[model samples]
Target: MLDERAAGVFTIAATPFLPDGALDLESVDTMVDFYVERGATGLTILGIMGEAGKLSSEESVAVIARVTARSDVPVIVGVSAPGLAAIRALSLAAMEKGAAGVMVAPPGNLRTDDQIASYFQNVADVLGDVPWVLQDFPLVTGVQITPKVLRRIFDACPTCKMLKHEDWPGLEKISALREQEAAGARKISILCGNGGQFLLEEVRRGADGAMTGFAYPEMMRDITALAHSDPDRARDIFDAYLPLIRYESQPGYGLAVRKYILAKRGAIAHPTARKPGPALSEAAIAEIETLIARQEARLSAL
Candidate 1:
């Protein structure tokens, strides 16, 4: 099981679909191999990047089983859903299939701190003995959990093991949480997720590692390694890819960009994103190619 000591890059994986919109099971195995070869210490499937909502429950379980069977590292399954029954059922299925743990993002319509705490308390009650990660991504979940509220939930539930910290402008929150731990709060492993945008600063603020889906797992692996051992070198490496990272940070277009790049890298069979998603504009593709060229040049110089 993944614990507080878990660190390094835990890449959020993209779900591959065929041109006909069927789940590409073959591509799932290929994608797992790609992630492990690229330096992912862990892999998260069915995440926001994985297009979790678009999948049926049966497809979701199949994807989890396929990934766990092939992944060398621990696999974290995103089981976030509208109801505890659904979340509980999915998490149990994932655990049965050998998942390292499951991840939960706060459901929508949770506005107040008390409501948030209560909701997670119910989640904990349902999860019971299953270890889970608390995904505190305000940008997507629309639920802001303050450090105080988070501490309460952590205290109330011991099963919540990790924090998938993706709160924007949340550096102070990380610092504050570390301070609390120093002053005797329960220590929760914090793996940040924001497409590697604020990765360097996050590490400086005491993040364990990156859990973002930025397509380039090696960049997360190398940059965080140097951030720990050599700040100057980490910055130089981070700077080279900063431009492209920013480009790929678009809200809805990000996952499509990841799939496109993954296909080009031979990680997946196709770059077919499911419907109801924005298509990659010609201008967006041109921009990404230019950034990739610049990124390669910078890396070559380094």
Candidate 2:
């Protein structure tokens, strides 16, 4: 079970790009080492945080292979393709390349509950014995895995062991799952997926851990520690970090800000994102610099 094996802070890492917009393997290695050194329990690569949609299939596979080779911790590869065939192929490839587990979104189309359940079942069938993480991001993928549908999928696929719940009313679903488990339903780990903004809240509501994309790995560790060690103290840390989280969560600047922080911390070679996406405005860049400066000063004080 993913929950039993990986019940701590997991980072969904960003993919680093070169100045010419190519995948930077060296930078990827550095980021992997940085996270593992800072206490990440596991690594989720080729995820939304990694800009999975932007990478080619080969690039995605290479990223998974490199991270898996470099890290001792579990590597969960994100399989986010829309079509069932494509997703199945990618999942199999990830498994073959030594990915510890596969994370999947519901079939990209707006699926009916039945279709959604069947989609997961098919993925589990194709994956054979490999563990799977059900990624529940309704806004981006346009499919909602209702509780009833989730029940069906879990019943149908014993290998579907975890879920990354990103639905808006996610805590309600987590509560419902807990109720089901208490009443003899099968146990499945639920990981929070809505960045770090809601991570502390999700843990309080019973999430096993998080798959957030926030820049500061140590801050995330602090959040997790507070959640487990002292709930009230965790809330205090979350509140104190709220301003930085809000700034980093902005739509157009989120990735840029994260990469900038990584660069500032000497974790990555460059803060470049793939082309077709516009560059961060000078104002946004300055804001990120200020945030980075504040973060450094705060960390130094600690």
When summed lDDT is taken over every stretch of 10 residues in candidate 2, the lowest stretch is 1-10
lDDT of each: 0.92, 0.79
lDDT of 1 at 73: 96
The runs of at least 3 residues in candidate 2 whose Cα sits more than 4 Å from the true structure, single-residue gaps closed, are 1-5, 295-302
lDDT of 2 by residue, 1-302 (tens): 25434666678888999999999999989999988888788888888767888898899889888998898888888886767678778888888878888898865765687777777777888778878888888876778777778877887898988888888767788888877888888888887776677888777777777777777777678777778678877776676666678887776567887788788777789988886665678888887777667755665554
- Clashing pairs counted in every model: 0, 0
Whole-model lDDT for model 1 versus the true structure? 0.92
Residue pairs in collision within model 1 = none
Residue by residue across 136-174, what tens digits does model 1's lDDT show?
Answer: 999888899999999999899999999999999899999
Model 2 quality (TM-score): 0.93
TM-score of 1: 0.98
lDDT of 1 at 125: 95
Best by lDDT: 1
After TM-score superposition, the amount by which residue 216's alpha carbon in candidate 2 deviates from its true location, in angstroms, is: 1.1
